[model samples]
Target: MADELKRRLVHSSGAGLVALYLLADYFELGLTWPRFQVLMVVLAVGTIGLEFLRLQVGLDWQIYDKLTRDYEQDQFAGYGYYMVSMTVAVLLFDPQIALPAMLMLAIGDPISGAVSDDSLKFVKGPKVLVTMFVVSAIIAAPFLFEYPLAVLAAALGATIADGIKVRIGDYIVDDNLTIPIYASLLAWVVIEFVPV
Candidate 1:
């Protein structure tokens, strides 16, 4: 499959599964803050595992390579970061908040990458990514958490930080920076707000 299509499938599938799982679990087990926490950990582990398998087996490396070029190595690093952030969010935030943030990472990040690669270019810095972040925040807010504004703000903030760290730095920023950072920030926001 094309990298863009693959990414879309991966992200949408992963996020959809997480959302479905959360909804089912909530209804079945009686929704609580702790359950949401557990869900985030579970989703992170599962998503990371799937991504690891895909990368290690070279299942999608060709497309990934073409899309990322020299920055492919950083993609693996991103996976680790994503796992850590998701775990933290689960431990710290409400599921309602965390899940939407996860969705942003899961759905928005990849979609943005695909869009940027095929349609938009970052000639003027991370403008494309920043725009993607804003759109993602707006879309994700209504579905993911009660404090949509706060979530959107957090997403925008993360976008800025990522733009600086990855797009504007002298050092190599790696192509994998987009999705991981986006997801991590969402996870962080979710964790921060989850009832403790």
Candidate 2:
């Protein structure tokens, strides 16, 4: 339980990046969208490099033993997927879409993890699903208030990503990777195609 709490806390810290971006933008600190995208890409690349070392080079860090689940021992840890997914979101979507999508993973996923039990069920319970949706919607609301449909779609996407553990062979698609991508993609679809 302590380890899970620690993991969720670390997961939530990803929101700091979004906060930094917002502050930089609001205060005109010169962190433009392109600059932020570059930063995300660099961070993702670095994480991927670290993952390669951890997986292929057998560089086992002590922190991994504490934070990672048994399943992650032989697979890409969530952080790598998180960085890659976030980079993809930032590069592919506008700030209005990317920021909330990132928040869904940073804020919503942590909250869901806090409420979840130890069981690694493929599908989370109704309680956890509802909690994820609500948290995700609230996270999206400030950025996407003008587009209610987009907000709904983003929330639903985040909920689905967090609620269901999609398995691809032996590796479960971590919600850390899926949440932002799913939210951004669904929100983009609604914003681009649906006239609401």
Candidate 3:
């Protein structure tokens, strides 16, 4: 189990670091909505493709059997469904907000997962919640600084919604859902209320 967790942590962390670099570079190129959308489509497709390769090659399982053990067949299928849902949401909303929301999820969710897995001190529910909130807030800081309050509010709302979804047990709303929703809404609201 420990080995499996380590593998997952390493894989996810590497992915996140790469994503951060790409996103930072992309933003430096000029933070435009169209560019952000293109980036998201590429990322979404790439992640999906990687997951498919993992399943098809069976090499991922060999590295960590716990991947299969942790996710049931239906749960695995649900990942595809969730991805589709997120893609639709991004298409319908502003990618400026969506991008940051996605980043928050990308960064915050892993922090939560890592803490949950490794920290005996954070084993309690309150500790976990506080940790998640603090980590999420830090992730939100860049968005809040770059964008407006409305965008931040949207991101906050989305994060809360994701928390509710996870707690309710209807579906596992990963960072993908939480970050995008917040970012998108924040951008939308800011664009609506503020003048250019």
Candidate 4:
């Protein structure tokens, strides 16, 4: 139980990364869209490089111990998939869609994870989805979501993506990756087609 608490604390602290989305809008990080996209790509590549180093040269730096608990044996960790997915989402979608999606990944996902019990069916429960959707919608509220249905769609997609894991061959899709991509795609599609 104590270990689980520690994991949740580490996971929830990832919400602080929501500041990455606000960097340009609030903090004036001077990160233009192209630069931000490039940065994300670089981040993904660098994280993958670090994972390689961890395997080959015994890379040891770690910000969160709980995050790396399975790293020693697992060839890939959630953070790597997260970086790659975020970069791809930025590259593929407009900022309006990408930012909210990334926000959901960074903030709402942690809320769901920290609240959901491991024994819950499908790694999720009503409580988890409720918290995830509410938090994701709130975070996206001040953004470019002109339609309520867009917000709802993104929130729903994020919550569901966070709750489920998909596997293709030996590669399992991490929630960190799935949440942003799925939410962004859903919001974009909904705003484009749904007359809301």
| Cα lDDT, all candidates | 0.55, 0.92, 0.52, 0.75
lDDT (tens digit, per residue) of candidate 1 on 156-189: 6445533434545645453333443454455455
lDDT of 4 by residue, 1-196 (tens): 6655665565455444446656665777787788878877887899889888876787666553456555435467677777777787889998888877887876677677778775626457778878998998887777645878888888888888987767789666678778888888888888899986
Candidate 4 least-lDDT 10 residues? 63-72
Provide the TM-score for each candidate, comma-separated: 0.58, 0.96, 0.57, 0.83
Model 4: runs farther than 4 Å from truth?
1-29, 62-66, 169-171
What's the CA RMSD of model 2 in angstroms? 1.2
Q: Model 3, range 105-182, lDDT digits (tens) per residue? A: 545555655655443331235444555566655655665566546544654554454344453456454444444555
The most accurate candidate by TM-score is 2
lDDT score for candidate 1 against the true structure: 0.55
lDDT of 2 by residue, 1-196 (tens): 7888888888888999999999999999999999999999999999999889999999999998887888889889988999899999999999999999998998899888888884878899999999999999999999999899999999999999999999999667878889999999999999899997
Residue 167 lDDT (model 4): 72
Which 10 consecutive residues of model 1 have the lowest summed lDDT?
115-124
What TM-score does prediction 3 earn?
0.57
Candidates, ranked, lDDT = 2, 4, 1, 3
- Whichever of 2 and 3 has more lDDT, that candidate is 2
Global local distance difference test of model 4? 0.75
Give every collision pair in model 4: none
